[model samples]
Target chain A: MMQKRTIEIGVGVFVAAGIAALVMLAMKVSNLAAFTNQQGYEVTARFDNIGGLKERSAVTVAGVRIGRVKSIVFDDKDYEAVVTMNIESQHDRLPADTSASILTAGLLGEQYVALEPGGDEAFLKPGGDIKLTQSAIILEKMVGQFLFDKAAGGDGKKEEGAAP
Target chain B: MMGWLQRLGSTSLSVFERLGRGNLFLLRILAALPSLVLRPGLVIAQLYSVGVLSMTLIVISGLNVGMVLGLQGYNTLVDFGSEESLGQLVALSLVRELGPVVAALLFAGRAGSALTAEIGLMKATEQLSGMEMMAVDPLKRVVAPRFIAGIISMPLLAAMFSAVGVLGGFFVGVGLLGVDSGAFWSQMQSKVDLYDDILNGVIKSIVFGCVAAWIAVFEGYDAVPNTEGVSRATTRTVVHTAFAVLGLDFILTALMFGDE
Candidate 1:
């Protein structure tokens, strides 16, 4: 009887713990899910590379996650990644000419789209496209570019123009 | 000189032998998977023991690791006059490398050894043989449940570790360290990507789970002639598994981050 009681208690504890873990998972998923139906000013941004950028990636302005990527589609004709993001309704005053930059989380981390609100007084409407967008700057390419530039212009000294 | 050469040769052969044994054992477990899965009661019980009971330690250790990381990273960054980057450094370190590996190591040390010893004792008592004679497959009855439990438990532990670690970092970095709370949170949000860190964590957990379960179950199953043998096997299991976990961490980190 004691053994049976212990076993019952153990099973109960395990079930409760598993339920708790599921609850936590549910909470986090729900938080992320809330972004799905959030009312926001929709804007499109085009990029040459959406490296590691997912559909639900955050759209941040000044490091605040005010929106999320709604969709990402390849523009076959333009050869660009067209990303549709939904800015929060509260921050709907972002100008039509705002620029977006694809930014890395850290040195070798995932990427997110960052929007820099423009100075224009004309507030961007829903379903508008951000005119300017910067693609992810490939780290290897940047390193290569740096080396080339350094070798070409040695010691930060300007050389006489010899090329015709 | 002869003795030294003999020792070296013996050690090399032993390493190969151990690897061969581990591989064979792994194949045995894989072969027994179907029957193991069919035993839901055993699987559920093992899950409770391995995963549910393991949460406390995972959380406590995780928090300390994160707190220490934040405190130390903050101090170092302050020395370099880049204190603003402390949050980024803390988050990156916790997520990318430290969280999953360290948590797994601790789990192996605690639960992994316990598992080996428990099963080893049972084997030593002839209970395993008794079950075998009673038409029960020990692999399915004994090993499979623990294996599945380990796999399921590891990820849950890792998730708890990551969450606690981040919270700990936040507490130390902002509340105790007196950095601007706004800047700290902003840096975390901007500089931490869920894809890289979280995904790596899940992958590592799965790998670690399999390795830990293999070590424990294998040690128990292969324990030799007597009580002392079982004890020795338990000790060896813990030590070997810990080293293996660290070694695998290095390999996994290299594979995961080599291109990046």
Candidate 2:
């Protein structure tokens, strides 16, 4: 009977743990979703190569994550990568001519979209597309460009190869 | 040189034997599935063992881990003149990687070995064989309940760990560090998404639970004769489960975060 009681106690502890965990998880899910929706307003950007960009990837300005990529679609009519981004509504004044570059964090880190706002007074409206987009810099292409730029320049150092 | 070669060969043979033993452990997991399904009470008991009792430890450890992350992250970000983004970094790092993996490792260390030791001692006593003689399947009675319990408990532990950890980060970054709570929360909410953080954490928990249980049950069943043998099996279960959990975490993280 004592042994039976031990088993019951053990089982009770286990069930209680499961209940506690479930409650915590449900709360987190609801809270996190609400938090994400607080400042995000949708905008679209076009990229020639979206490479490793996925839904929910970070969107940064000057290395600060101000938004996230909400969805990625391919436009058959233009044969371009159409990336829908959700910028925090608080950061609403990005200029119309802003250039979005597809960037990677490191040699093997996750990818993000980096926006470089242009010197223009006209701000992009929600759902408006940012026209200037830089494609992902393929590793092989960057390496090749490095070698090419080196060979083509003692003089070619005058113009730097494009920023990855 | 010849003597050294002989030593190498002997070590290699022992390693292969252990590998073979681990394979046999896989067989035990497969065998336990049916019994686990039929015996719901046992499953519940297992869950209680692995999950509920583990809460205090996970919470305490989780909070410390988060506090450390905030302190370290803030120092680095401040050096770079971007200290305001500390909340984003802390939230992303904890949710994306650290919280689930660390909690699972702790569980494997604490609970996995206990399961293995209990089973191994039972095997050493020949009671396991006694059950066999009575036409009872030990896998159904023992292994199934453990596997079921592990699967159920790990996610719950992970959830507690992540939530507690996040709160810890909040205290350090905003209250102690003097960062604005509103901006900190804003950065976290704007940058981190629900699905990316939660689904990944749950997936890691499930995988860790299965692997940890497998190690414990396998080592226990294959324990050699005598008390010393059972002791060795218990230790091996703890060490192997911890290693496998870490290894699998790397694989899962790579797949989830790779490319796009």
Candidate 3:
């Protein structure tokens, strides 16, 4: 009888410990747990290119996180990327003329949306759009442009001087 | 040449026969599961033996593995000047793959071998036959509880491993290596998803649990009813669990993480 009681107590403790671990994982180790309980409003932003921006990526205002990118869909009509962002209710005072840009965190890190708020009498409302947007910069395109300009200048100028 | 052909054919036949037998045993255990509810004590006791006893091994291994991951990830990411992402690296890898896979393997080694040996010894000593003589179904009384305990234990063990592992990584990264504590935890939280990473890991552990427990109990129940047979069954349990866990991990990973 006494041994059975001991076994039960041990099993109880084991189960409790396991459950506590799961709770910690959910609370401390994942993002959804933080945002799921809070109220948020969705707003759309359009970009020429999204680069590596993914759903659930951070949306930050002045380097402080305010919300998450809720969804991304291709705008067939405009030939652009339509991004839906979920901004926390606490950050509702963002100005109407806010600009949304896709920016990489480090040199080669995950892409996120950065919101640059413009001073306006009106504030951004739910379902409102951010008008000013900058697309993600492609490094290869910049490098190719630099090389092309240098090549054309080097050949055309050098040949003119030599022939003269 | 003829003798070799005969031997190969017999071996193939026996392999099929064993597979069929294992399936039948699993079915019997499933059928007996409903009755297990009437007697909770059996499962609770088995839980102590199977789950509680294995806790020490799981916790220690999880801590050490996390520490190693933290150190290795820090060293590698430091070269790129991205040591702050160490938390994300540790959490993602541990939650997605290492936690479930390692915990299941250790389970097979600790609880699985013990289960097989315990049941096999009973068979060898004629306790199983003796129970049958008394009109008791050994499958119901002996096998089902152990199987239930094993299946229940694995996911919990894996979760604990992941949680503890994250802390272990914190110890190495923020404490020793001087990674920013805020960046360490914040990056991990933002990058890892509850549904995608943690819940999927739980699902993986559950599947691994079913496979490991099924093989362990099946081997024990089907032992040759001799001293040598019992020992062989114990060995087979560990080897089979390892292969099944690793192979299934690949298939599950492709299915789960493939889209991402």
Candidate achieving the largest TM-score: 3
Q: Per-residue alpha-carbon lDDT of model 2 for A1-164, expressed as tens digits?
A: 77657767876765565556545544442246555455667989888888888987889999997888899999999999899999998899999999999999765666999999999999999888898889998888889999888888855555554533
Model 1 stretches astray by more than 4 angstroms: A1-164, B1-14, B80-85
Question: What is candidate 3's lDDT per residue for A1-164, written digit by digit as tens?
Answer: 89888899999999999999999999999986676745799999999999999987889999998998999999899999999999998888999999999999888889999999898979999999999999988878888999999999999999999996
| Candidate 2: regions farther than 4 A off | A1-164, B1-14
Question: Residues B107-211, candidate 1, lDDT per residue (tens digit)?
Answer: 787778778888888888888999999999888888878877887777667766766776788789888988777666656655554555556756887798888
> Worst 10-residue stretch by lDDT in candidate 3 chain A?
A30-39
Interface RMSD of each: 4.8, 3.6, 0.6
Model 2 lDDT tens row, B107-149:
8877788888888888988888988999988888877788677
Predictions ranked by DockQ, top down?
Answer: 3, 2, 1
DockQ of each: 0.12, 0.22, 0.89
For candidate 1, give the lDDT of residue A94.
Answer: 86
- lDDT per residue for candidate 3 within B1-260, as digits (tens), equals 99999999999999999999999999999999999999998999999999999999999999999999999999999999999999999999999999999999999999999999999999999999999999999999999999999999999999999999999999999999999999999889988989999999999999999999999999998999998999999999999999999999999999999986
DockQ of 1: 0.12
What is the Å distance of residue A48 in model 3 from its true position? 1.5
Q: Model 2 TM-score?
A: 0.69
